[model samples]
Target: MANEAATRLEDVRANIEKACKPSRREPDDVTLIAVSKTHPAEKISPLLEAGHRVFGENRVQEAQQKWPALREAYPGVELHLIGQLQSNKAEDAVALFDCIHALDRVSLVKALGKAMDKAGKRVPCFIQVNIGQEEQKGGCAVSDLPSLIELARSADIPIAGLMCIPPFDIEPAPFFAYLAKLASDNGLEQLSMGMSGDYETAVMLGSTHVRVGTALFGERRKQEQ
Candidate 1:
């Protein structure tokens, strides 16, 4: 298992380098966030041994439970919340994760601000955009981004950039392109848009962060609740 995970990690890094070479962007220029949601800490330990430290989780509860043990076992791992966090879990989430990716609404922003105030710690956050206008996703509508960005800027937390998940079956470039435009228009340059399936397109479209799973960890298992 360790050997396989190491091989896959090397392959993914090579792919990133190959994909971004045309743009003059070194693979190191993009941060690869291994999306470990639903995968156990035991399964993740090998990757950590292989020198991969950044891991992304989708749920605050799952992370709170899973990471403490992992942190004790491997103290250097960085946890990033890449899911739509419930405002009610704001305090705990802010305390647990190093960064957050799906902060779209103003209400969540305010809630996290209050939570950070209580904790006296600010977590880095990304503004999520519903670039596809999909009703099922939990991001702010594309039209409302400027206002959200303004709100994020006024808050004490540092706004890292933008994150978006394009519709599953569509070409990821247009969606990535839209995020790139949004970031450019707002004078922000970081774009986090990509996954195991379409990260090459994402790199081609100027993604600063690529959230990858499956390809790195094989298929995801059912997460224990």
Candidate 2:
């Protein structure tokens, strides 16, 4: 298991390097977030042993249940919440995640602001934009982005940058480029775009963070009936 994890990590890093070459950016400029949602701690431990420090999870509850012990064993592990955030879970999300890539609404902005003040810890957040205008997606509408950014700033949430999940089965470059432009227009610096399949293209276009799951962990094991 450990060997497999190491091999996958190497592959991902190599791809990141290859992607960086054409873009004239260093591989170090991009942070690879191994998405560990649904995977158990045992499966994640090997990657930690392989020196992976950044990870992302989809749910606040699942992360709360699994991360405490793992964090104790592997200090300095950075956790990112890369899923849609419920406004009610703002406090827990602020408390658990070092960064959040799904800040999408005004209510959440207010909730996270209050949570941060109470916790005395400011978690960097990415404003998620519905880049594809998909009806089922969790990001804020493209037209609402400017207002959302302003609200987040007024509420004192550290706006790290922008994040998006382009509609699947389409060329993602344009969406990634759009997000990059949006961030620039808002005077933001970080971009949490890309995933296992599109990360290389994302890197070339200006992604500061890539959330990879299947590429790093392989197919997630089927749940027991």
Best by lDDT: 2
- For candidate 2, the per-residue lDDT at 174 reads 96
Off by over 4 Å in 2: none
Name the candidate that leads on TM-score: 2
TM-score of each: 0.96, 0.98
Minimal lDDT window, size 10, model 2: 216-225
Give model 1's TM-score versus the native structure: 0.96
Q: Give lDDT per model, in order.
A: 0.89, 0.95
For 1-225, candidate 1 gives per-residue lDDT tens digits of 899999999999999999998889988889999998888877888898888989999999889888898888887888899998989999999899999999989889999999998999988899999989999988999889988888877888688999999998978788898899989998888888899999888998899899999999997545543
> Which lDDT tens digits does candidate 2 get at residues 11-94?
999999999998799999999999999999999999999999999999999999999999999999999999999999999999
Q: How close is candidate 2 to the true structure, as a TM-score?
A: 0.98
